[model samples]
Target: MNLDRSIDDYLAHVRTERGYSEHTVAAYRSDLVDLAGFASGRGVEGVAGIDLALLRDWLWTATERGLARTTIARRAASARGWTAWLHRRGLIAADPGLRLKAPRAQRTLPRVVAERALADALAALADRAAGDDPVAVRDAAIAELLYASALRVSELVGLDLADVDRRRRTVRVTGKGSKERVVPYGAPAARALDRYLEVARPAILAGVAEHGKNAGGAAAPTAVFLGVRGGRLGVRSVHRQIAAMLSSIPGAGPSGPHALRHSAATHLLDGGADLRAVQEFLGHASLGTTQIYTHVSAERLKQSYRTAHPRA
Candidate 1:
């Protein structure tokens, strides 16, 4: 089969059968497409032509181009998975990627907003949301729930009306790998959600109807968050909103929804929440993934000690 066609087949298998998220599948596609182009330039026209040497050369070219270690590592992983799939299907006699290696990606601490700073920011958001402006109220709710539940932006946007249980103070979110989990929210988040649902959501949808869109008694949108055009709220919109809100706060690293997630997890860990419980709360499939917060906590403690302790 053509190399590009084979890559597409593998992508489809991962997306549908293996249940990889679109973001992951897209990354794999990018890596593989670059590999195909590199191979084609070397007169390699088929999967059979792929070999360990070519794979190594491709990685070397990436390194020479000054790609970050994380990018190079991800590309290597992508290539390994693709070649492994091909070998498993008997398309190749052996997996060339088995010996593939790349520089280890550096592990950086996730950005954690100071508790005071975050509280002040949320208070300001709440003040802005006290009015009947649909977007403002929705933004407040989004920010609250994002920090409260430590939701990924994708999971937050994917939430449907029925997924939320206000009385129970919980939401059912579909996380990565289509894993479903019910997570609880604190009263502050519950209040924000209640206000959004009671006032903002209806006003926004009503505006859509006034514009002659979603009219004629169409079925209501099920998404908990809605764009101005009355469709499900998109991931980009949420990112833009959160970025603008976090811009003024003094902090390093990304000022995105994930910062709130990282903050939530770190705060939970600092408060002495169990490591395993936090892993489940974040829907991390592995305990090791959640253990990073312990390092963040330790770093924070060291910073505090350095600043406050009296010594020679």
Candidate 2:
């Protein structure tokens, strides 16, 4: 099969059959597209030309170009998966990528906002929401639920009104790999959500209708969060909101929605929540992925001891 056609078929298989998220599929597409261009430059356009030597050379060229180890690693992974799929389909006699490898990506701890800092930030948001500004109210709810449930921003924005069960104080979220889980939130989050749903959301929608600017059209109305233009909230908008919220607080690391997620998970661990329970709560397919919070917790403890203890 031709390289581009094989890539398209693999992307479709992952997107539909394997249930990979669009973000993941896009990453795979990017890596494979680059590979195709590189191969074409070498006068090798067929899948048969993708030998182990060629794959290694591609990674080496990426390294020489000063791409981050993580980027190169992801590219290598993308190549490996595609080549294996081609081999399985009998398009290639053997999997060239079976022996392909890249430098292991460094594992950095996720950013965890200090509990007091996060609480104060939420309180400030709540105070602004008290003015009954629809956007303020919505932002408050978004921030609260993000920390309260430790949800990925994608999962948070993808929420629909029917997904929330206010009486039960729980929300049904579809997470990575399209896995579904019902996660509970605290009363604070529940209150924020109630105010947004009962007051803010309707006002925003009504205002959009009054102005004849329902940019979201039919799709906006059912979403749990909406942009100012009445469209469903997007991932970048949420990132900007959370980034602005976290900017003033003193912290190193990304100030995005996942920082709140890392904060929530670390705090849960510090408060003695069980590891497996947190694993389930975060909808992590692997407990190993969830164990990163333990490292965060330990690091926090050491910092506290270094600051408070008088020992040499």
Candidate 3:
């Protein structure tokens, strides 16, 4: 019945039973901790003390403290989920959050690098990788596959050697909610991946052997991408690499691997790819989630027309 105990139990349920990702579970933990602290200050320390008014006031206090609308909305959702769980478990007499509401977060369009700019940037990377420096070769492959397949950084890092089909130019990726999809890569990405596998990957494996770190026994490490230490690459490393690359390019919004994803999706739409097909390609569960690219495309068209039309 303790609020803290209930929150921990709910988080464990979501993580173990519901299969929510670590990142999602962490966010829920953060929100619930903050709410628990707020509730304690108001003499409400038990699950039974949680009421709709307390929930609304907590959100109002968050807004008063100038938290972003997205943060406030997410906090509301977290609290609502927690309260609902308690009610379902018979800890609370009734769910107080059934009518809970928070301000909607403003939806902003994702940053889309111009096709020419992205092509030029990749060309520079390819040239650097031509010398077959292991890191450069691996980087080129990473960037190419990211943009080509519009893959999430996690999906890119999660790839195992057997998941890729070089002949088919496709990679099997596991996306959100543990959904698996086979996505195709362009010729450029295929070439880059081949170079990495043939030239660079061997060098890395040799380095790993030198360090006596081939702990996977007689079989090679299954990870398609590896760190300098010969272990599977991490997501933060990919984010750092892509952010550094995108930082040099002029743009607003995010400067990370996701920009490549946004660019690929927008470019596909601009090139007249079908909306639903693009949705499936991106492994989006909702058509509405995929529709954001259409907005980006329309915004680009308006900007182009404004620049070209003399009547404006």
Index of the highest-TM-score prediction: 2
What is candidate 1's lDDT per residue for 181-252, written digit by digit as tens?
999999999999999998999999899978966554444489999888788888999999989989999979
All candidates in order of lDDT, best leading: 2, 1, 3
After superposition, candidate 2 runs with Cα above 4 Å error: 215-218
TM-score of each: 0.97, 0.98, 0.94
User: On residues 1-312, what C-alpha lDDT tens digit does candidate 2 reach at each position?
Assistant: 789999999999999999999999999999999999999888898999999988888899999999999999999999999999999999999999999989999999999998899999999999999996999999999999999999999999999999999999999999999999999999999999999999999998888878877644654778999987788999999999999999999989999999999999999999999999999999999999999999999998899999999992
lDDT of 3 at 290: 99
What C-alpha lDDT, on a 0 to 100 scale, does residue 120 get in candidate 2?
Answer: 99
Q: Which pairs, if any, clash in model 3?
A: none
Stretches of candidate 3 exceeding 4 Å from the true structure: 211-220
Clash totals in order = 0, 0, 0
Q: What TM-score does model 1 achieve against the real structure?
A: 0.97
Task: Report the poorest 10 consecutive residues by lDDT, candidate 2.
Answer: 212-221
Name the lDDT value of residue 187 in candidate 3: 92
lDDT of each: 0.94, 0.94, 0.91
Model 1 has an lDDT value of: 0.94
